[model samples]
Target chain A: MSDRIFGGIGLVIAIFFAWQATLIQTSFISDAVGPKTFPILLAVLLGISSVYFLLKPDPEPDWPRAGRFAEIAFAALVLLAYGQLLPEIGFVIATALTAGYLAWRLGSKPLEAVIVGVGTSLGIFVIFKLLLGLSLAEGPLGF
Target chain B: MELLASLGDGFAIAISWQNLLYALLGCLLGTIMGALPGLGPSNGVAILIPLAFTLGLDATGALILLTSVYYGAMYGGRISSILLNIPGDEPAMMTCLDGYPMARKGQAGEALALSGIASFVGAFLSTCGLVLLAPQLVKVALLFGPAEYFALFALAFATLGGISAKNQAKSLFAAALGIMLAMIGVDTQTGVPRFTFGEVHLYDGIDFLVAIVGLFALSEVFIFLEHRGTEKDATTGPRMEIGRITPTWPMIQSCIPTMGRTSILGFISGVLPGAGASLGSFVSYSMEKKLVDRDGTFGTGDPRGVAAPETGNNAAAGGALVPMLALGVPGSGTTAVLLAVLLALNITPGPLLFQQNPDVVWGLIAALFIGNFMLLALNIPMVGLFTRVLMVPPRILMPIVAMISFVGIYGISGSSFDLMVMLIFGVAGWALRKLEVPLVPIILGTLLGNEMEVNFRRAVTIADGDYSVLISSPLTIVLWAIAIIGFIIPIFVSSTLRRKMKKDERDLTD
Candidate 1:
């Protein structure tokens, strides 16, 4: 049942890629098969293989447990927020929140997470910007 | 003779204070990351890739540090596997088999020390192999043409299939999909945009980092969410002492044969694309099982099993660099990250690297030596300290890891678009994993996609529409033969093993 869903998705994605490859510009290099050829070949290969696997996969292997999925979702969302805020909130503040959140998830005490998160952000700032002489943009928080 | 000169030049590059500092930093960071159970060398290297980009050092120096981290993590991973029973990565998985057993027997100190020594031996021996074999391999590589390159890629795909035996077809499909995705940017040939969907950022093509982080790290989050754990013992065995950091000379001597054999095996296997350190460790462990027990005393806390896999994995780490350094091809996903760095630096890695960039080459070689020594120093005394990382609750640690992944990826482009792609890739990657597909091949396929495309185009261009250019060159024919034969052999070997396994199962049932 799962296989059919994935196979269908794979087939659609393959078609999308095939159609896209056909539109790419191919002039920098010399006389050749051009850019479209490889992607089209890949699409065909994927379409066929997806069908094959959907028909016959190995004996079921254990998938990751439920908590793992939650953790992944939480991380992805937090990371998405981190990227959105870094430029506006500044590296130090954004990073601190990000770090603290991660530390919390990883098992640090609440206070410890905040401290470590803030400390890590400052430390990175000092090392990269001050010591290494790389310039990082200061966000709205101004630190 | 020629090799000696190169070694001398490499020494000159490595001995400098700046490069030495970079190597030490890389080693220290790598050890810390490796000691963490869930974070392996690949993530360590991947997470810090943006830093390398932001810092923008000379190609050689950047590569030296990155490669050093890779090498150090290979050694440092043993620390966790031995003390905590958590393998840092797939290669270290074998170490847990006997290492944890030895640790449970109150030999944590001995296990840690032995594994460390085994790692040093494996890495050093593989370096020797690289020094001896690289130039010769380069010369042989010079004979390759477009068709040969394609054939080499085929062999890589085949090996990936073999390694992922349970779902070879699915793995290939994923790989092919990755290759197609790589084709989304503007075509260099006719100036046409392929799959951009009108987004300007997509024109630069998919950044390898975005794909990798999504596939490996982000998906890891989802997987982790599914499997929450209960509390365990707070304390472990007697704390490791400084005196127990080094293996006894006699103990070292006893395992020399296993170490030596695994090093060679690991190095040889590592040179072939798609056959990463995981396979190297497995092959080595099996070989040790055969040699250590004429009558079978293996896997019952025998030090040979631990030593064999540890040595094999470390050596394979070093061996894997050969293709990366000499041929510009990565033997595994981690090295492909390095390849991306090289590309970003406008450094083309191929036969051209040695001829055009001597300093980078030598500096990297030198960094490897320093990096290994530093790893040993850092890991030996700190085994007890690092083992404590396991005590931390996954709840807190998971959040911080997520944050790092978020900040690191965002720090790169400062664009929400990249983050969005990351999310999509994460979900896709998770779905693929659920279907029993291997992730390495997808990354590998993406890394090799453009190369294959260009070469195929070039081959045809050279032939001027002639269909026989693929077989016209002797080198191409030879490579094609090797690819075909190499692929068939694995299938034949695996079928025999499968039959033997089934028969053994039936015997047990009766």
Candidate 2:
């Protein structure tokens, strides 16, 4: 079941966390419970919980079909790409592309997606950046 | 009289033009944010927080704005439930049971108006509860030591299961994950870097704001992408006309007692650690149904049915503020967001908060009172606007949601690395949610992790690494008992509640 896989992954994470906790350097002046104590305790707690989850797995999760999975994966990728591209292409351009792509995939007609994307990017830029004085990533055009 | 005198000064500050304007703007924005079916209040507040920060408001102005968004979102949540059979927030789910039915029976307007009134009653009564209770809690919190604080934080994690998550293990796991996330920054007490992984940005640890915007906001985009292929995928109901807008004097008269009693019950639930508005609404609805549903009219569009949960959840929303102000441990996820705001503003909420920042605290309470009235006015005349928001295509809406997340987080943190971390949390949050893990515990863990660790460290150091110090005191013992009972009791009770919450009422609106 997916629960076992989740638990196995959790177990792996716990082990890695324990190793990292062990590696943390403590100053000589620090008290009895150093920085590593809490993290190590957490790792042990996670280890026990993961073992329990593995032993008593829940029912199989209702997973999507492969094509549906691809769509979900792509959506996540778009979010990732939006964060990645924000600095490169500037906020407005990056946000426009990201929002336009997401809107288009979310069921807007292509033209409507473009319009929605442009409007959203501009609206936020003017309101959030220009008016409110919140900083955004600047492109070559200075907006 | 101490409360009275402080409240007088509070009114003076809260009545300022700048503070009132922030409150009004926050109310307008929160209603729209919450009405956009699926964004809910947590994300609504989270998305708009950057704006609050950027607006250059003082802490008092921000507090007024904060109360507005809080009450405004509470009001807006019921709109989608009544019109679209979709809960605009977790607490609003209860409203859908009778609200959609009322809407179908050509009473949508009345339902909106009545729930608005019930919301006012709940908010008003609970703010009174907050005024009376927070000072008392501050007195009690002063008795807490590091050991007792450790026990209290553990109790919080145990009790925060709420209604949605049936698996306690998953909630615990999420909590652990959040603590580890919190450990990413350099250790505060020691100069040692804990888990920065050689990344310079990791030195600051995971910003709870970035994590919040990502977890609550961006994951919503993913969930929307998953469920929404077309307009008709989730919602199945007729676009009924919102008949008369007013609940007649008779209807309001009948539900008056229900709203009054549920507000009290809901306030108590909200005051309980880990018991948030979800439980508040659920318990109130069930209690009222048992008390008054003699003809089984609780769910079949009964006015009391709509009033009970509305009052309960809104009251619970106000109740959740009590602990956050007095103890600094947020009783609900939204309060957790507000807690972050307080911390970012350099206001440490605890027993000292009363003595240190009377203006901020009193002003906040006074503004909450004013904001409740503002919400009532907005919810009634603006029901049409909210329902129309429900009809907005996900095509346009989801992107705006996504855009807001990006822009908001970017603006608030002003760091691309934080944005990337946010996206990562977003993906992981989506994965964790699919696995049925509760996100609130994760948030609570992140918010409280450093404090929890420091308390434990302080306790241990004082006792010279004596582990028994963790449960040495009566207060710690009591907190531990509640924590243990809270984590275990849900296993037996959730099944019954889950069965009661079956998906049978799918077509309440036909």
Candidate 3:
């Protein structure tokens, strides 16, 4: 997005936050500036800065091309999916799958990627769970 | 003197076999981390906080290890900058101007050696400064009340804004957004949720580590992915000859003066809340170029050119520790991560830290002294080995980094929700970086937001609701003046400088 559009969006978010700040209910007011004061101050500062950005945007906004957007989106999806699957499928399996996929995407041979994936996954599991004694999510195939 | 006595005690703790070993491990890990492209001291420390906790080291041991890593990374950053022409971190960016030229000229080994020595000298001397200056600074810090703290934070913000990317407004906005994020969770004073939106997990607020790891490490991975195929044609430079790893005595002698000057300059810059290692290295390099490199050989493999930035950056690393040690404020992002570690350990840093936790404070200082020496020894001999890390392909390295971030955060919080938060912030951080919004101020704002609010409220309460109390104190007045000037001068100076440069170009054309 262009700086002007991003700034406009930021301004809207800041306005929403400012309104939310007004709704914060404080039970006991010990100080002159209660809980809402700082948030309001921050929201106002953000709103003003957004307006400044809208007034003068960068001439050449260095946005990534559409070609590279797919890669970035894929990586983000992989991470989000990894987070979701970490507890459900457990550490080793989730890590292996995600790491393998990412490595392969980045140009590692499929076999090398698989080795790296399983190795890193098990390696970290051993280090954190066994050596450091931290509890990690255990998969169906324990250890 | 009490300083001497405390330092003596510090040595006793630091010299213990366990602490010494931890320091060594930290230095080794820190150097490896620093040598890796796109992973600097801040990311190194942030990614390893959980590991430190998992090891169950006492506060002093954990601090010694982590701080040793911090210093070690400063030393190791020059390795990649000199060898691969890819700076391992921002502070090492200056090193690339000269170090890369030296490498292309087959003086890579000598460049690496000089930077190692320079880093040692810079870190060692600045640590000595820390030993001497921190106690006195802490005494001054003890005198600061809520009003003073508020002003001090303002000064920090203003200075950060000044040093941030050319757009001061954007930097301020990012900082404000960070503060807004910090407002999530239940308010300590009012027992009301400000922005939690009724989520039970939001009661304690967002974890700063999660934010840091996502913003720095994960965001870095996304960028790495964006440029992955583009760098396939890039070549690793000539292998460093081991025999040339040791600088000639005269070459070392020439850099001594430059190192001395830059170390002092770097230390002072590091002590400032906003100006960290990058500024120190930049200022030192520019100053050295103007002062000594009159023949115009600065960017073309000059040893002194390599020395100035290497020394300045490492010295600045030591200097950056002062605020976090003396005042509960972090002077840089890396130190902010360190502060987070301390907070996680249930240790509050400030004037009281010295009296309340002398072992943690003093032991860390003494460990820094040892860590610098260890880094010099490790970096000079292992320069070749460290450079080999550049050969590690991003495909393998980046996924491991991601795993470390995932496992490390999970180890600490043991919550899947935080992992999701990290992933979300990682994408947000990448977008923000693309937009040129500086991340340091955001981290600083989040770290200091609660304290800033608490101090502001406390000052107001003490003044019986008189808002003027914030500006009443002499110290606060001076800080406010500095803050205001800091904001105005940078914009004014840069514009004039740009105008002059343009006019000069036009004149040359004529």
DockQ of every candidate structure = 0.53, 0.76, 0.76
- lDDT for model 3, on a 0 to 1 scale? 0.84
Which lDDT tens digits does candidate 2 get at residues A44-82?
988888888899987777666677678889988877877
lDDT of 1 by residue, A2-71 (tens): 6767777888877877776676656665465766677788889888977875686455556555665577
Model 3 chain B poorest ten-residue lDDT run: B501-510
Fnat value of model 2: 0.73
Instruction: For residues B176-229, write the lDDT of model 3, one tens digit per residue.
Output: 988888888899898888788888889999987788889988998888777766
Candidate numbers, best TM-score first, in rank order: 2, 3, 1
Mind giving the per-residue lDDT tens digits that candidate 3 earns over A1-143? 37888799889989999999999987855467788888898899999999998998866555667877888998899888888877788889999999888888777899999998998998998888887788776656664
Query: How far in Å is the alpha carbon of B404 misplaced in model 2?
Result: 1.8
| Model 1 chain A worst lDDT window (10 residues) | A56-65
Which residue runs of candidate 3 sit more than 4 Å off their true CA positions?
A28-30, B161-164, B231-243, B495-510
